[model samples]
Target chain A: MESHYFPIVYLFGNENLAVNLSNILMITVSMAIVFFVCFFMARKISMYPTGAQNALEYLVQFIKNIISSNMDWKQGKHFVMLGLTIILYVFVANMAGIPFELATQDHVVWWKSPTSDPILTISLAIMVIVLTHVYGIKMRGLKEYGKDYFRPAPFLAPFKVLEDLANTLTLGMRLFGNVYAKEVLMLMLVALGTSSLMWGIFAFLPTIIWQAFGVFIGSLQAFIFCMLTMVYMAHKVSADH
Target chain B: MSIFAIPYVRMNDKEANPLIQEFTWLDAIYQLAAFAVLLLLLKKFAFGPIMGMMEKREKHIADQISSAEKNREETEKQLAEQRRLIEEARREAKEIVENSRKMSSQQADEVLASAKQEAERIKETALAEIYQEKTQAINALREQVSTLSVLVASKIIEKEMDEKEQEKLIQETLKEVGEEL
Candidate 1:
């Protein structure tokens, strides 16, 4: 894969950092889309919602259900905003590359799903994991939160630490892998179509089918991401967990 | 060539590792910042107002329902009161009818008794009147009888002796008695 990099050198000339400009641009675009959709839906609210407002409320309710199912409302209420943000942002990011991927002839990708990149997805996962820890300490107090690690046996503490690392890796990689695979398959199909007329005809049907399936995968992945986020949050915050 | 080209870095296509190329702290930092901003804006503008509006609507609906229930109860109470009043009036009218009927029947009985008493008194007066008239006619007849007897005796004494003369006197006396009667 090709990328657009912007390098930043340390003032001491000790190290260099490369920023992926494509990811930045795509991430910003996705955020803007999510924000505008929410803004318009919430613009002229009424007692009885209709059209966009109805859809928006349904989304809110859907996130609320996900939160409530994992934990009680008192603990879950704080997470509704976080849940909405994740679901909307990840979903928009996942769907952004589907219709068409923007790239040069040399395969220099300028625009695609930001979530297809591991860095972005893992960043989101890290943020969520960090928030859960923050909330756990805030709600349960640090001593109680630390005691939660030793719950069935004091010997389980090491494995518990490993589990948090594993959880972060899987949560982030799951979204990245699915979206990346879909994009790769799409690119392959496009290449096959360009190779020959006969192949083009064959590739056309598969591409359309894959795009439709891609939509389902995108939406499902978004929901799964949110569900796991709340479940992880519940584990950290809830007394029973 | 672009405004974002100032920090341009040469491509490292030969690295042959997609994961190594994609992972960057700068991208992560930018994504985190962007996501945080989005969360803050959405919470303030969208979620807060909508949830508040929903709660208000729910309260309004509850108030309306309670007020409606109160109105229905009041109307029902009024209906019951009206029915009671109508029932009382009906009972009063019936009582008035009953009293008038009793009074009229009593008046009828008194009139009948007075009329019967008048008839009896009139019958007694008629009987007394008939008796008095009969007594007056009898007394007048008695006086005429006495006078006629006295006149006849005197004529017989005034003319006595010879047979032919006595017979002529007797005839004259008879004619005079008849004329006097």
Candidate 2:
């Protein structure tokens, strides 16, 4: 049997019943950090924005541009809050594990990228899918919204349902897979550094180079994740989709 | 052998670590709750007010531009009205000057005519008074000459002839003298 050294769980006790408590703690802390930064930036709004306020306005306009590009502002304006939340949360979560990681007394990792797990990403995907349905139903009456499932023929309803499931699954799994792979590769590089004396000669340079590349990949993943969420939402809300 | 070695697409048996096996429902619930809380906080504090401020600023700029245009229009109207008033005042002043000039000229002509009439009346009165005085003086001189001739005749008759003849001559002479005068 193959064996691995890393513990997915940071710590375990009778008091903790939640699955993978380490990831949960990381997620909670990341959420709190995101909320505090957002609150501080959003504290003072003015007619003429300056400094931090200007940065905040820039973000608002950027999100507005994204929404308007995909669909009309009339229909897309309602999703601004969701877009901001997703982009900020995902970006922060992506880079959270990059700086430095901590280890617990039990030799398990206490800090890592929360998005690397399937549970959190899948939950987010499900929430997005459910919200799209809610918005579709609200915008188009029940009779009209239900008509999309039977388009082109009545026998294709099951396929359309399958399509929805596939879309959600892929959306969640894409993030989880990419982040998990990045973690594995970084771990391999670290292992290469410590495993052999000859390997140590080239290990430090490649590890540093890979870390920089990881930063780029992390940012790209956050952008793609947010972009896909908006696109999926557009399909549900807009008539052209 | 594979397309870019995608993670989920490939069956990597070595990755079947015990810790990465199963997904729990509780974590999903927790994630949902966490996201929901995030959405609520951001919606309340961040997105709503920021967007509102933007709209408000846009409206304020539009209002300022329109009001400035209105003020310019009002100033132009007032300027036109003032120009008209000034033109009217100038016209009135010219009319007043022209009327006064006409009145003064007419008054001078009247004064010249009245002075000419007064001089003619004075000359005519002096001529009438001089004729009247000449007539009175001639009548008085004639009466004195007749009286003197009668006295001389009476003296000569008393010295040379009778009284009746002398009286007849004096009457006839007095008659002739009166006719001639």
Candidate 3:
């Protein structure tokens, strides 16, 4: 068995229902940052956008394009906020731990990306999948939504269930794995540098290079997450499917 | 493996397996709630007003464009109307000029005809006056000749002579009258 300490807090003195304090803190911080930035950008809305307004409009347009590409405007228009929230939250979470990490000597992590944990990402994935189903039923009616599983052939129903499972796992794990690996490599590099004076000098360049690469990966993942989200949404809501 | 074999830090001390093995329900719930709240707040404050403003701007521009087109068409129509009026005025002026020219020429012809008739009347009166004077002169000349002949006959009767004397008396009277007349 392998174990690592975390800053855990039990709810109602139950071990099974414990919460990781670090994850919660990071999640809150990410949410706060996303909310404030969006709020400030949208505060003084103008017809001819300038400065932050331009950037905000550009982000809206970018997300709009993503949605439109996946589905028509009528169905796609509803998901713009959902897409924006996801991208902003994920991107902020991904970039959070890259600048610095906080951990105790005894392996108790106080600060890291919220998305670095599988529980958070998987939870988000589950929520997204559930929302898709809800929208599917709402837009196409429960009967039609159920009929989609048996379409092209009845035997394909089992495979469709499996595909949903696969989609949730991949969506959650993909984000978790990439962010986790990047942080791990960054920590390892820092550890290697601190191991000796000679290694410290050599590890400096690679650490900087890795950090730069991490930025690119974080942004790309954010975009991919948004894109896949709209695609899933299109699958659920659109009539042509 | 050898590189990670540091003295103070054990390989197993790192928190690697906890990521998969540990699952926390509270953390997930907290994150989901936070995300949901953020989405709701952002939708109300950010996306709603921005989208409304954009649509408003688009409609305003469309209205302006349509109004401008309408104004342009109106201007063109007025311009054409003005041009037609000017053309009508010019035609009327030309018609006025043509009537005046015809009137002046007609008056000139009438004046010339009246003057010629007046000149002809004057000439005819002058010729008639000269003929009357000539006729009067001829009558006076005939009367003088008759009186002269009567006087000569009276003088010859007074002489009272035979045929041979009478012829001599008449010859003498003719010589005397020739000398005197």
Q: What is the TM-score of each candidate against the true structure?
A: 0.76, 0.72, 0.80
What tens digits encode model 2's per-residue C-alpha lDDT throughout A77-135? 88888888887787788778776556555445668788877878888888888888899
Task: Estimate, for each residue in B79-123, the C-alpha lDDT of model 1 and write its tens digit.
Answer: 999999999999999999999999889889888888888887888
Pick by DockQ: which candidate is best?
A: 3
The predicted structure with the larger DockQ, 2 or 3, is 3
Task: Give the lowest summed-lDDT range of ten residues in model 1 chain B.
Answer: B1-10
Give the share of true interchain contacts found in each model: 0.51, 0.41, 0.55
lDDT of 2 by residue, B1-181 (tens): 4322221211124557544543445566877888889888877887678778888988999999999999999989999999999999999999999999988888888887787787778778877877777667656765666567667776655678677877687778777876775
Error of 2 at A223 (Å): 2.8
> With candidate 1 superimposed using the best TM-score fit, by how many Å does residue A38's alpha carbon deviate from the native?
1.9
TM-scores (chain A) of the candidates = 0.94, 0.87, 0.96
- Of models 2 and 3, which has the larger TM-score? 3
Task: For model 3, state the Cα shift of residue A169 in Å.
Answer: 1.5
Comparing 1 and 2 on DockQ, the stronger one: 1
- Sort all candidates by lDDT, best to worst: 1, 3, 2
Q: List the residue pairs that clash in candidate 2.
A: none
Model 1: CA > 4 A from native? A1-16, B1-6, B13-15, B75-181
Give candidate 2 misplaced runs (Cα > 4 Å).
A1-18, A104-107, A152-159, A193-209, B1-15, B83-181
**DockQ rank, highest first?**
3, 1, 2
| Global CA lDDT computed for model 1 | 0.83
